[model samples]
Target: MERNTTRRWARLGAVLGTGALLVGVLAGCSGAAPGADSGSTDTDAALKEDVTLTWWTWSDTTQEQADAISKAYPNVTFDVVKLENPDAVVTKLQNAIKAGKGAPDIVPVEYQTLPQLTLGDALADLAPYGLDEYEDAFTASTWNSVNVQDQLVAMPSDSGPMVMIYNKALYEKAGITEAPTTWDEFAVASAAIHAADPEAYIANSGDAGFFTSMIWASGGQPFKTDGENITIDLQDEGTKKFSDFWGARLEAGELSGLSTWSDEWTKALTQDKLGTLLMGSWMISGMDDYGPAGRFQVAPMPTWDGEPASAENGGSGLAVTSQSENKAAAAGILKYLADGEGRALLNQNGFPSTIADLENPEWLDHPYESYGGQPANQIGAASSASVIPGWQYLPYQGYANNVFSDSVGKALGSGGDLNEALVEWQDTLVQFGNEQGFTVNK
Candidate 1:
């Protein structure tokens, strides 16, 4: 799951190349320099090169994936630097680039932040290196994430398809036989659960990221661009439908007004004071840690009707920095790391839905007590494919999300004018984008 509470997504904005201020204290990114004798040839002589590559990551991914990649290239050694802070990673990377020294050969950037990171041009475009050959190897959403203006910015690593997890006991207590298939049904369930137990809610009030996911699920295209000019449609029908639904629920006291991932919310979840949690695939493991054993069940997110659609929540990929001396070697490691075997190894720490692994028979085998032995990974796999297409993010999406939270998030809990709040958030984003040398659209 998350490295920490805020670090999980707050650093989603970390990809921006803002802040010219250079901090002398760089986060640790250590490894030995490459020796001589490395070659593209498969000859034994190439083994003598022993290229050591540094990778900076906040996710505590095990070394198995790195080790597997090392076997693919005997001359390559991976020095994995697993940090806990995502913001520090962004700072160290930018500062290193500014100073022209001390950046890691490879770094992980979330898909949500890739568009923002592209503005800096610090990531190497792998299209020139023939990375397009593997273009169809990953899913469409993942493949799309790696490309910005036809440039392959990074290799797709893992995916986090948005879904809902419910407290099984709580749902049963409220007479919910199956997961709510539609939003109307969900609302009915929410009302029933709260009426039966006034202390409980169907779900808690989440932040901008969660709202963005719901917007995507409703097929709302919030952010997009046509080369130079950006088009941001925050007040779309889908968004209005989503917000109005939640707004009414919040007013009726059927939904918890507490912020997601907060201590109060977590307590509610553990104590069965909440009914369901609308979140991403990574939350599978997270829910286990927060709730008592055998109390939760995974299900596809409730839809407007019965159509399958979702939003990508938290996913990351590895990008070779433009500053890396061993760009070719770094790309090789990244490519090897995203393959089937590498993905399996990576999935040990984080859920993966890469092209090869998504359909693997083993995906349906991993059982969680929280899911009551259900193949939750399979549910995540299916949701990954159902994500709404053309759902793009602004280059300054992190700043926009922050602004949305500051304005709209505060309004959501108190049954304030959510539509007005969104308008304010949109205006703030337009201003930010225009100031950052972009043509803003609304």
Candidate 2:
């Protein structure tokens, strides 16, 4: 185990060397101040290292996660710094690297931002870190979020597979017979529900992020590449199909606009005022907290127009920063989290596992009685395999997503034109790419 660990860190060092800035960024990775080791004894055993590793992440339960860390690695100590906004993590990491102090050994990078992190040389390649050992443990596709230039940088953490959670009791009351499988069927069912109850309709948010998910699931790519210019293709067949379908539904007054992922929206879910929520695997975890038990049921996301596919929503990966003096120790902890008993614990605590393990069946067995005994983890396991694959990680990912959000929002807004909005977004992405030192094609 020690020999293997050495080889992994050596390989990891070589990869970090490719990015010039990382050399300076990682210069001050050693020195950790000793603390009283206050978390879980179990995690402390798993790490078993005589060093402390700092982790920068986003989570509601820092103490619980820290406890779990201690439980997994008894010898290794972890100092977790929690930050909420996804963008803040990148900013903080970059600042730490620049300051040459207080940098984390391991960091959690969202899948959407993988490309940007890799391009900037802000993260270390984790290939030598026993990635091969844990590769097969994760669902095949979700595991690649951190793969850039063929080097694996992150361990699969959680995934968001698209699902439609509905109010079964509400459907019964409205005399609606079936859950929607396609856009057409969804519209029909939504109309029936609306007619039965004047306040009900399918839920929609005029948000571009949600639209991007729908566009991909509907068999369309948002930006087409010509050498390097990301041209707007939102007016393509897939976009038109999605916009026309949803627009028609809205115009028919069979829909109610609710802000996305907010407390008010969750309240509507409990009230059964919304017919369906097109969300990801993590939705199941929120159900118990938001709605009463036995009121809802889970179904596959409504299809756009083909063999049903889901848009990849939320997922996280573990990246070992180049600056960590203890790369081997970091890798050991990541491997345990991705493959050992840690993955199962993450799944049970509301973070769906991206890694496949023997513990999978055990996790799935604890059904959510709130969704009428729905085996959501089981469903997520299957759905993870079918996610539409091309969420191409971009070097300027944060800028691109912002552009996508803006363009899609404009297109979906009342009187918004899809073509004009997309053109503007595409132009913005090109400008940002060039400014970030990347070659942008015209």
Candidate 3:
């Protein structure tokens, strides 16, 4: 909303060095250097010497991606460690950096975790790796999510742009001609769908996090600050209004109060029990597993009856840890992953790429027959362009999630009184921000 480019740059510069590094010291005994592998893709053979680049990633990569990387870059050996627990990754990373041993070269970081890693100084600044040159190739929002303080600390691999996915059959059954474009319309349309089918409603009505994501889409920031001071905005009128609307719907028995991001919700989605879902682009893969192929379609997220509106859901970025011995090599690896070809490779491996890889007509445009014969890949890519960027991802974003989750649980668990729980959550957030030395004003 702020169009003052020069002022925004100035603000970025001011906060770039605001946080102090927690700890950063590369560990472990002497390891193999870069280009040590020689023979096959095996570590021993590829490096010739013993070159092991430790990589910590949250989830498993596709076999196709692994095979391609192995074949293309046989000289570098990667000790890829898959993590089932994400918090453990951060904990282990911090401990390794502090102890000066067994530190990983690359780590997959969620957008929300940027502050945690960067504040600790465990991650490397990626500017030297030609980040500037490839910056324009990525979606503006995706690229800016990882580029904080004018420092490109990480390369964005994938992002979750909020999307409105609906069951065309359900909507038609409900006699709803068009998808809702505003919150009021969304509510009215949802009520009509429920009236018609008794089971139709928007996505899960029980999840407050889902509501928070929607609130943000309406141009409401979770927290607002004047650089030196922060304030909790959860109890603001905007949030309360959303809570009331969503809560009322649940209480009216017009919606299923299932948890968003849960298997139950997925079942509801696949079975077409819900009318529409405010989901992310990455959610497409699960559709094939849950719903019959080609059953749903995507529309823009319903607005807040206000200004330009959209909210990002989930995404991961690639960050080079300071512990990496081969920074250049690591950067090179990222360069391959973030650019057009690299993005395409990521898409091939199940990760959404911001770069338009469907430019070639020969490439499969319509990969799925489901969804009433729609070109999903192209539609999903076009949605990426509408996402708003340059928002602040505070260091204590995890705390914010905690606050939201607890508030929601309390509201649902205690007779649906969101206001009381929100007041408490707001206070907790203020305390957290202050304790972290972030500005928190009353």
Candidate 4:
């Protein structure tokens, strides 16, 4: 119940710019650079206008956030629409963007979906409204995810820094007292755990997205584009080496062939048959809620070469849509959401991205019954700090992601030689790019 509830909140709206009709909507950013717009709009000037902006978000608390915003700028009225299904939100957004009308003033977007919403520049650029001023204000990677192709496209509301969540009781029963610090050590431990109890395994078989995180942790850049020149590399040393390790173990039964989040995985996790889960920090609340409690421990994810590294996962952002006739009002609302009362509302549900909030007692001091009273915020902050940068998602990541899932079975889907599957995934992406009219580079 807790996992489903929190995940719902995390899937809400984000920022980015768009269209020719959008040219009229964003009159201030007209003829602006494809990247950041001119940083000269007066946010206060926009706030004075009588505007009733619509916000499309997934959380039920959005109405509460809208109420706060309405109070902050009394002249600005906000209409908050709560959609229970994330796919429906994205579907409405897509329909609006394509028809060139009906899009909300602001909407919640997952960071991974920014490139899509902002495709052909359909969302409003926040830089002109002073969003870049807070560039140093958010965790670098989370901020980077919002800035598609060097432009401030969305305001990051929350982030999911990756970490290793292990069942402490399971480890103790397997005679392992410490979490592995390196992949070499991790593999050894995986073998030992399986040997100790044949029913136990380290992790699920996972999918392409899962491998993408692991690739990021290992310093691999799977997808990158320079305006027109796109580069695709899934067969990098790190990916190849990591795939080799896991593929061998999976075949040997050291690691479970179970898929993540499935009924099998949930039972294994609750029963302590699955020892460790390397995932985004958002999983902490789920672990605490679903598990027996006081039986979990978090550590920076194990590194490939023992270098300081980790990956990130599920995070959502907010953006101004092309439908808004009031850019100033929309930008103000986004800024307020990121740093104002909306931030508080966001914190009520998921992890925070505000720099000062990291240490603010109001944030860092939450000692909930979860984790047996450990200050989970500190652990979250530390995990976020360990993230290695330079990983980027392509503009067509959503399309490519689906294709990769079908082609490679996500992460070694149905199991053959995972390395060969990587090559196939690589070729498929390159082909998809060419078909989509991108100049595919090696």
**TM value for model 1:** 0.85
Please give the distance, in angstroms, between residue 48's alpha carbon in candidate 1 and its true position after superposition: 6.8
What pairs collide in candidate 1? Answer: none
TM-score of each: 0.85, 0.81, 0.79, 0.85
Model 3 TM-score, all chains together: 0.79
Residue 79 CA displacement from its true place in model 1, Å: 3.3
lDDT of 2 by residue, 1-442 (tens): 9999999999988887766566554554422222222323233243564877888877766557767877756777888888876678888887766565556888988777777666556666677555666666666566656666577878877777777888887787777667877878787787888888888766754465566667767767765433344445556777777777776776677766667777777677667788777766777777776567877788888785647687777677878776676777777777777754766566555456555442367776768788777776666656666777755545666777766666655555554555566667767877777776656654
Give me the runs in candidate 3 sitting further than 4 Å from their true place: 1-50, 62-64, 85-88, 98-100, 197-200, 206-209, 224-229, 235-241, 306-308, 350-353, 358-367, 413-415
lDDT of 4 by residue, 282-310 (tens): 77666765586577877778887776787
TM-score head-to-head 2 vs 4, winner: 4
Please say which candidate is ahead in lDDT: 2 or 4. Answer: 4
Question: Could you give candidate 3's per-residue lDDT for residues 1-442 as a string of tens digits?
Answer: 4679888987887676443221111223222222221213222232334345677876777335645755667766677887775667877877776665567877888776776667666677788666667766667777777875557888888777777778877777777778777778877777777888776566565554465566556555666544446666765666677667766765666767677668877778777787777766776555666566656876777766644457667777888787677666667677777765656777754436456553444343656555656666554565566665545555666657766667666666445676677677777778888887877865
lDDT of 1 by residue, 1-442 (tens): 5568678566655643233222322323222222231323232333346778888888765356677777767788888888666656766776676655677878988887777667665677776555667776788887888888768999887778888888878888989888898999998899989988989989887788788888888888878876668977789988888988888887787778787768988889888898887877878777767766778889998888798888888787889776776677776666556665655666676667477777778766778777677878888888888988887877777677667777888787677888888888888888888888889883
Model 4 clash count equals 25
Task: In model 2, state the lDDT of residue 384.
Answer: 67
Report the C-alpha displacement of residue 19, candidate 3, in angstroms: 31
Deviation from native of the Cα of residue 290 in model 1, angstroms: 2.8
Better of 1 and 2 by TM-score: 1
lDDT of each: 0.76, 0.69, 0.66, 0.76
lDDT sort, best first: 1, 4, 2, 3
What lDDT is obtained when candidate 4 is compared to the true structure?
Answer: 0.76
